[model samples]
Target chain A: MRVSLSTLRILVLLGVFIATVLFFASQIDGYMNARLFNRISGSVAVIALIAVGQAFVVLTRNIDLSIGSVVGCTAYFTGGILMAWPDLPPVLVPVLAMAIGAAFGAFNGFLVARFRLPSIIVTLATLAIFRSILVQSSDGSSITTDRLPAWLTEFATMNAFTVGDLQVRWIVVISLLVVLTAHVFLTRFRAGRTFYAIGSNPDAAAFAGLNAARTIFLAFVISGALAGLAGFLFLSRFGNITVVAGLGLELKSVGAVVVGGVNIFGGSGNVLGVLIGAALIDLIDTSLVRWALVSEFWREAVLGLLILLAVAADTVLMRRLLRRKGGAA
Target chain B: MTWMRSWEGFLFLVLVLIYALNAWTSPVFLTVGNQINMVQLSVEKIIVALVMTFVIINGEIDLSVASVMGLAACAFGWMVQAGVPGGWAIVIALGIGLACGAFNALFIVGFGIPSLVVTLATMIAFRGFARVLVEDRGISGFPDWFNALGQRGLVGPVPLAIIMFAVLAVLAFLILQRTAFGRKVYFIGANRAVAEYSGLDVRSVKIRIFIASGTVSALAGIMFAARVGAIRGDIAQGFELDIITMVLLGGVSIFGGAGTMSGTILAILIVLALRNGMALQNITGHIQTGVLGVLLILSVMVPIIRETGSRLLARVR
Candidate 1:
């Protein structure tokens, strides 16, 4: 009959979400509601995609701070390619971006797994290194709509389906599918399950014959690849690309994953929770603009506060769980 | 230790080599005025780096230091612009830094949360706070007397800020290398549980170290504002990387329980000279940052490589 802290948190989050939606519904008309949903889904898609990858890394007790830079670099790289070859196939662009991201991730993995350097330090270096390269390569110039291929821009606006006059973008569906697949993999796959073992206690996992370093390395790679994918989505959604396109997104992904009930110290939490967490964050972000109670300037501050609160709550709940276990034993 | 035997010695040689290269290549490199200006550019960052050395040596980090510097700088500028005395504004800036550090320590030491997570959150939060406080506009136009201390020389070619850095470096070196408090920081970093069991008050030491980081960061913030004569929320953006680069490049182990003030000083000088040399050669800022990033990765990698190589050799024997 004892529900875990994570389950309790999810329930509380659901209640808050429902209340917020109801409050907004009462304040705004049905047309505005549809518009809000459309906006939320569109913004949440890229954020959720990055958050899912971050969740994988966090579940392995490693963080990929370079994710934002990877997304930025990949976006710029994609932009560069499209500008170079206006006739290039749309599908191949994403593949190229993912490959680039994977390479970056592999570099991070080698340093972390092979050298045993901390993920934070390695990714922190890569974060600057990658962004600096992007800036240097671009020479501070940005890729605008005029440079992008016509098909890619059209693909950005293509609708997946309409539900009662509410049109959902194809990008949202793609992000949702990503979430579903990641959820199943985390729940069922042996490789995914090994992440928890490594995250919770790498020494114990190593003793049990798990290649903790390799697993952690793979986590970083997956995170990187997903970030690249997210970059593709970012490019399609926003045609204008700057050198700082994905700046501070690593913070956003970490915030989403932690808020989704995945422990910041790693191990535990689900993708479904991350989906909800991403939605909540984007909702708050947009709401700041809509409500005008607080300025949009406070978005980063709020994200930070959310992370701190979530971690603090998790810590207290975990201690309680431990105390209860000790009492029963 | 022999000159060639220590990391500081290695850094010294690198410094000399860079000096030689710069001297041979750039016409302005060897002048006393230019050299002073070169060292002056990094004084604030080096000040922050000195405290960061202690934080890293204690097996903790405060990513919020740069943000703290920004916020404090902005606050000082705002206060001075609002007609508060410059000296009082500096005090207020340092106070803000102290509060910021205490906030980090409370969550980290009191709540028993990881310093990384705590500082990461504060880093974002504090920067956001700075943005909200100053918005997009920058504050400037400080008094002549205040500007003189940070931007000009008090003692013939030695800017007041440089003197401050030197005095602080010596103090940090003494405290870290000579005092009981310094020894305890190392003990706690090496093994926190063991240190705690021995009743060395690990939490207090961590709190003190974090506070020192905040205070020093604030001092740097005030100095930076004086030199630049402007304060923006974005001041010191990405400076955490440079400060960390210096600490790591100085041979300070990111893992904690290792590093020295002298190593950090030499590393700071090397970076300052390298930056100056690059500027003289007309290298762009982004390229400089890229080089530093590569240097940071290599700084941590080389030691690990050496250790592993030694282990492999031992196993082979």
Candidate 2:
């Protein structure tokens, strides 16, 4: 059996990720080691959820730059609602957030799919618009931990399991559930496979009787819904919601999706790959903190470099793969 | 009647209606002083938007423009504050701008990487580099003459920045309207494969456009630093959205191949007038930003809607 390029890339990244963590764990103190894993799991939880959803959209050869803003907007919506009515069940928070996110996503789909506007520009515009709405509604103030109901904050920090001394939070479990569900849908469902068909070649997909626009729209809507879910996780984990709650998240998710072996041009990748990609990004962040060699400012710069390297490698590898196939035929 | 069917005509009518509304609502809206001030505030964005017009027209985007502006300004501020001569600092800033543009071109034009992703990476990377340079601190104390030039006018009530922008806009207009290069840009944007088969240097044209965008953005940064009299790494952080908004609102298709400088100029004025009137009415900055976002969406949506409507009509006929 031929090992596909995406699977191979993920394997290599996973290997590098484990080796880096093991090497650093041996060199660092026990407290720092626990701290490193804690940060990785916690941060990766929210990012993985967002990245998984984003992978769907990117797999359709369209990008969503508005998810970060959607996250911020949805978090504020949930946060605002909880503050206004403390008796609201904690479960309702994520539901409301997902609904709001889906609405925004539908709007984006309407423009991109119905009208056929470029997705990037449509999302960029919405990013600004959604963020401004969040700001205006909040009156430029943050909903802090004090305002959050006790149960909501408790759920945020609830420990799911312990690995020796390192405790895993419930958010990690939820993130895993999201990933597994998405993985199954993408691998097992006809609707999920259509996304790849659309991304690979929309014209061909259309000719083959696939509803390309509908599939693309579904991908974006799913991405938006997941981002909204991540917002709730963010609220629980941080216990604070500001106008800038999820700033720069769009780039971070894109970075993870690309690094996770998803083609930037779309048509390939999986939820499991995004999980590892999200872990690698968070690991890099935590490692930089643990080593204390580089300033915190370098994190974004490093993420940028990682995105470039990931995309460049994918492009080169893909060309080589195609050439091999062509030669054989 | 035919002109009314065109995008520029629609923009002109909108501009007129907005101008009238402002005049009716605000007693000072008709004053030349306030109008000049409005232009001054948006001049930097306008200048960058013109170059962006070319980029979008050529079927690519430069998301790194705002970051390049921020980076160039930071570099200039660091140099001048460190006692480098202002003249030399300006040259160095332009050179940095050129290098930044070339970097984008290398990935996009050379490697065939999507310009959107390449520019997105540079946008973050370049902004990161700027933040590392200036951190949270703001640098000031530019040469007196330079500050005056950036903030004040050569002619009565005409800012040097605004004048420089006008000259550049005219030059861009000519290059885009009257030159063979401009036609080539449209050709490539309309169909890159066809342009390549027709013997056009598609890669080189794309490279040149990205470079132009970078350089113009850098220049805008210098003027911005002069206007503000300080430089911070986070300066112009979200300006890319506004520049792109203005260009698109001016009727430049986001997919490329159809737009004009006149339309962009008209759109910029409309935005300026709207923001200026809102400021006069004491509207919050957040609300103003929201309005621009709505305008951005509507700009693209209207065209799509019109085309769809027309297609439906034709099918029925």
Candidate 3:
């Protein structure tokens, strides 16, 4: 029955989200053609999947910079596999990519769990390592899937009710799947709740007899797996796989995760909030493009602005709440 | 024994071994002109890594240094475009870089924001700002005489940049070692809470380090502009990875609190020589990233591996 402050903030962001959607829709006729809209939404969908994975990592108050590289590795591997055997069912691409992604994730897990190395450093190193794999494997070229399997085409196409007022790519469907699943996992599942508790206060979690290292490792696994799925979706949407395909993605995912009200210090956010954050970031980028900021640099500026606003808002609200309760943070 | 266990010691071994190998493989490896060229190229990165040593030591990372250089380089371009004297342009660019660096410090310190978060934001913003200023057009066209910073020598075979590098490195070394503030930074980075409890001004210390990082990165930017005689947004793109790799390779811990200027200098040389040697031997650019990636991985892995192995033996016993 209680509307918590965070819940209220989420509601406000949703409302802002709707308004931004309308603003873009109105400009749809003039600037964003159906083709452009489809492209933008599709890329956003792909990015959102990765962002959700990143949100999970950040949820435990850790980070994984290797998501972009994971995406690159997965996408490249999937694309490369498909290229090698064109007749093989494209449906298996996700499974194959997910397996590769899981391996990378497990390695990240091993480094963090066994060594107690900081997540950022471990992930950063792997970002380079995984990306280099794609580069070396591809020999500085891209592998394009010949054609989408029929089922994949069905999964990839996005539209309003499929009748076609506004064409939404199938990426939107997958993004929702990732988001909803993550949301349920974070809020309802035991491991998910444990992750939050661990992130909020690792020592407290340990004192409560939680296996902090294992939980962190699991978090990384989930993050990597989701990134792998996002990579599949990336290939399903963009046929070409380049060495730099997911380059700079880690930072963007961090931006979306943090901006969505996820605490950088770990714990205290949910997937639903992250989805909203991801949508908002996508909306901002699209709107900027519609406004004719053809120079791609402004995109970075917008991202920085969003990160600052979100962090400032989260920190201020949290501090105020603590102050009002007359307690130390 | 401690010294031998240090980054300097490790890098020294790498350098000696690499140098010996290069001499054995290629007679041109140890020539004075070629070696000076390597040092000359290393000047900017060495200086920036010196300051970054303090930044990482304070438990923060700044990804914006390369971007800061891009922007600072633009300051010079803007000067020349506005018809300022060449020397004036250089001075003004350096000043602007300092200001930008200080601004980064202010944002991080004033807002109590994490350095990673703040600099990440600024990295995009500054780069974007630089892009807008340049508007996809590069500014060159400086007086030939003004180009002497990159062109002329400092008494028989030395570059002005190299001299600048040594002086700056020593000053940075003193700051990080002799100065009380430097000591506080290392203490804070090693453990912020302990340092805070010990009455160190963690906030101020971190803010100053950010500024120092920004300043040095900007100086590097100016020199890069001067060296290549151009400035653009994507000019130094992807360079952060290179600098960070060099900084980390120099013995600076990624998690912070343990490195030295001497180590950074050795790292600077090793990176330069490796690249130069590779070039002489014709290694591809893409593979070089792989090399750096492997090196980056090994650096982190080796330390963690040792700790893990030692702990494992203890646990098993």
Instruction: Highest DockQ: give the candidate number.
Output: 1
Worst 10 residues of 3 chain A by lDDT: A145-154
- Candidate 3's residue-wise lDDT over A163-217, tens digit each? 4656755568767887888888888899779989998998899999999888888
In CAPRI terms, where does candidate 3 land?
Answer: medium
User: Deviation in angstroms for A310 in model 2?
Assistant: 1.1
lDDT of residue A278 for candidate 2: 91
- How do the residues A1-329 of candidate 2 rate in per-residue lDDT, one tens digit apiece? 99976577778988978887776666556635576677778889999999998999999999999999999988888888898999987777788888988888888887888877788888888888888888888887898999989988888678999989687999899899989998888889987788888888888999999997788788889988999999988888888888988999999999899889888887888779889989988887777655655566677678888888888878887889899999999
Quote the lDDT for B84 in model 1: 95
DockQ of each: 0.74, 0.65, 0.52
| Reference contacts reproduced by model 2 | 0.55
Q: Which stretches of candidate 2 lie over 4 Å from their true place?
A: A19-32, B308-317
Q: What is the lDDT of candidate 2?
A: 0.87
For all the models shown, what interface RMSD does each have? 1.0, 1.2, 2.2
